[model samples]
Target: MPRQKNAFAHKKNTNENNQNKNSYQKKPEVIQEQPEPFEDLIPRIERLEAKFDEFDSSILEVRKRMEQYAKEREEEKRQEELERVEAEKAEKAAEEAAEEARIAAEKAAEKEANKESQKENEGSKENQAPEKNSKDSNKNKNSNNSAKPFNNSNKNNKNKKRYK
Candidate 1:
């Protein structure tokens, strides 16, 4: 029994020590130093790096195209702005022209009304001249003629005798 107990105690202690050893042991990162110098490796590195340079150049070209597209869009916007201004100017000019035409028409209408009023005044003067002359001649003729008596009383006496 004592021998078995010592063996079992030895086994437990060995298992505990193994667990502690496993817990204490950290994994080391591997870093390999190349024998070649940076200068000696440049040509080979350049060969691989040329491929990345080509991809970078393609990306730069895409960026340049995008810039050009943005420039064209800005130019289109500028052209639209200019056109809008021109259209507004033309609209204003057209409205001004219409207003001018209306003013001219009003002036012409006023001139015609004045002419018609003058013609009416002249015509009324001419008509009054003829009527005034005729009235003066009639008044002179009446003053020259003798006063005439009415024969209505003689006609009434004759009509009474005939009825009787």
Candidate 2:
């Protein structure tokens, strides 16, 4: 029975090999495309090269415009920085001027106060000088009156002694 199975398998393999051989013999024909003529392709190649050149020129123009834009932006930034610095300087100057004005006002106020105090001192000194002079004159008059009474009493005593 094993020998019979082996023979059947051998027959199946041989049939498959025969079918593969027949398929190979009946292969489909391959059609080859002919290359285009050089004259016909030259214009097409030139058109492609022209388009490439146009693209390259457009790219260069864009790069130049971008560089110009960058320079413009840098210049604008520098202008803005200069303006900011000037504004700060102006503000600082204004602050300094204000401080100077405040100091000047303070000094003027102090001078006015000093002038007022000096005027008050001079007025008081003038008022006290008159009062002091009046008091001294009164004292001198009282002393002179007391000395005249003593002289009159001594003269009266000498007259009484002569009459006795």
Candidate 3:
């Protein structure tokens, strides 16, 4: 009977040891490992942020310069267009003035020619009046001689010399 009791006790002890070994093989609570934060890493991140800010400022400055250049080019184009228009207007005015002057000069020359023709007509009339008077005097002398007998004025002169 004593031998049976001791054998039972040894079996129970063996079972307990097997259960402890199985529990040790697996962890009851899991431990998570985290990396430690370093002081140097913070400064590196700050430097990267500063470089991004600088790049943004440079892009803004480039945009502003491009806008200024566009405005200047537009102003120059407008000025050139205005100058071309002014030149065209001035040329048209000059042509109009020259045409007016030519018309006035032609009118003056025509008037002078008319005056000269009128003067020539008056001179011809004066010459005709003198010719008419001379022809009338010759007709009167021819009629008086025809009315008397043909006598020589030399016979009268001979009689006058005998009397003296």
Residue runs of model 1 more than 4 Å from their true location after superposition: 1-48, 128-164
Model 3 TM-score (2 dp): 0.50
Which has the better lDDT: candidate 2, or candidate 3? 2
Candidates arranged by TM-score, highest first: 2, 3, 1
lDDT of 1 by residue, 1-164 (tens): 45444546657778778878898687776889866668778888898899889999999999999999999999999999999999999999999999999999999999999999999999998887555558878888887895776769989999999999
Q: Least accurate stretch of 10 residues (summed lDDT) in model 1?
A: 1-10
List lDDT for all candidates, in order: 0.89, 0.89, 0.85
Per-residue lDDT of 1-164 in model 2, one digit per residue for the tens? 45554556657778779988899788697988867669788989999999999999999999999999999999999999999999999999999999999999999999999999999989988887555558778889888887554458778999999999
Compared with the true structure, model 1 gives a TM-score of: 0.48
Count residue pairs with overlapping backbones in model 2. 0
TM-score of each: 0.48, 0.52, 0.50
**2 against 3, candidate with superior TM-score:** 2
lDDT of 3: 0.85
Which clashing pairs does model 1 show?
A: none
Q: After superposing candidate 2, which stretches have Cα over 4 Å from the reference?
A: 1-39, 128-164
Error of 3 at 93 (Å): 1.1
